[model samples]
Target: MRRVIKNDDSEVKKSNLGYIEGNSNNNLKISKILYKEQKGFCIYTEEYLGRADARDIEHFDPTLKGTSDDSYSNWFLVKHQWNKEKSSKWADYQPVLHPTASDFNERIVYDDGDYRVSELDDQEAINLIKLLKLDDIILADERKKYIQRKAKELSIYGVSPEDFFKILIDDDIKQISYLRAIHEEFKIDIWNLLPNPQ
Candidate 1:
């Protein structure tokens, strides 16, 4: 007896929804079409720009509004506004500068080494909290201890006793060297504590 074979063209066609291409532009075009179909609006600036051009919309430069200087400046303004609004909502949100500690100076000097331990105030305490939060090297307990020790050492410098407890919990630091490298080379405090190295 001969068996009849069922065709699976529909399933195959569904599986191959779109043709793959080695070129990035072809992929981008397919992505844009799919995105537009799903979301009505293209989130990608390239796709949006292309759409705008096709529609003959002038003064709709996606680059200018997406990533150029004008866009960046506008974004900065928006960010500043958001920050101000957030700070207003939270009274404790004080702005502190994160200057890279000098290599020649002590790795853990507070208040730029001018007032020593004698002149620390609420602001200084806040600053230390910011530094601790920014630095991934220190843990919660260690940060508290460091703040207390620094406060005591700088008590003569007018450090505040009450504000030293405003600790900010941080994510675990991944690599210890990551913090050191950033501080040493880039002069930036972008430490994120990771789980203990395996």
Candidate 2:
């Protein structure tokens, strides 16, 4: 998972719905803030969340335990499936990387479609990948497909290697962070020379 840059200026507050959400889907006050902060992606998986995927309000720390509704500090936006997988393991494993940390991108490296801890020996990275199954077959395949597609377009269009790297680092394509990391670690140069996507 990438380090999620959570905004300090959150609008959610401690409320009665600490145990679970209420019926009115439109009134998820805190979740609205998190959704905005997360930019419509699962904070854990770093995957885009579309309409068909169920969104879940994940408590980084188990709220059911002694923790009160101070969820603003201990919450995460995850998918329902992932949230279930992370169920009740509050203190069981301390993740090596965190959504709050700003250096997670540089700490963890992605090669092709596999994610592993960097030379820093970030065990939490290992724990998270193992526990969350970040390398699931389909997920890995998708990651590979994404990089291949980008690499193909860059090469096919006769985009200079400089331009390829430039696009990877372009601020307009912040979504390419992970894919860029893959390119860096793999040195993948295959391209299919196609026009840019509209």
Candidate 3:
């Protein structure tokens, strides 16, 4: 999954904490903001949220749900089903990468349709992959479909590495999914081509 650079404090003002904490209306507003900030992909699954997708505001650290830690930094918009699958299962180990805190691409390697910890052999990264089922057969199959489609598109354009880089940056994919896999399959350092995280 890509590193998620959280939005600044302006949109989720501290003054609205009461409303944000309990109001469904406020939560929807916040979810929309997060969806835009995250480029319409779930932080955990890295799946695009299509019009029919069910999503909600997820507390990254489930244990902190009702505590004072319930704030934007701990919040993300995730697909509803994945959120249910994650339901406080790894709260004690806390292995999942913090979307905004960790440099994801550095800690985890994404290949064809699988994920593994990078050469760093980060145990936490490995745990995160298993905890989230990032490489489950169903998910991998979906990723492979997108990967093949993008590969075909690139092939159609007869792109070299430089040309591919330009195309990736110039026409940013509206649904950013399996990006690391695409980069690895293409033998390109796609992360370098992207601007520094905000």
Q: Of the candidates shown, which would achieve the greatest TM-score relative to the real structure?
A: 3
True lDDT of residue 151, candidate 2: 66
- Report the Cα lDDT for residue 194, model 2: 16
User: What ranking of all candidate models by lDDT puts the best one first?
Assistant: 3, 2, 1
- Count residue pairs with overlapping backbones in model 2: 6
lDDT of 2: 0.60
- Expressed as tens digits, the lDDT of each residue in 56-142 for candidate 1 is 111112233323333111111111222232333332434432222222123233332111222346453344334324232333334
Residue 157: error of model 2 in Å? Answer: 5.6
Per-residue lDDT tens digits of candidate 3, residues 34-147? 776666667777766767999978887777787876777878889999889877577644566776656777777776677877755676777777777786888888888978
lDDT of each: 0.28, 0.60, 0.70
lDDT, model 2, position 116: 71
The total number of steric clashes, by the backbone 3 Å criterion, in model 1 comes to 19
Please tell me which model should have the higher TM-score, number 1 or number 3. 3
Give each model's clash number. 19, 6, 0
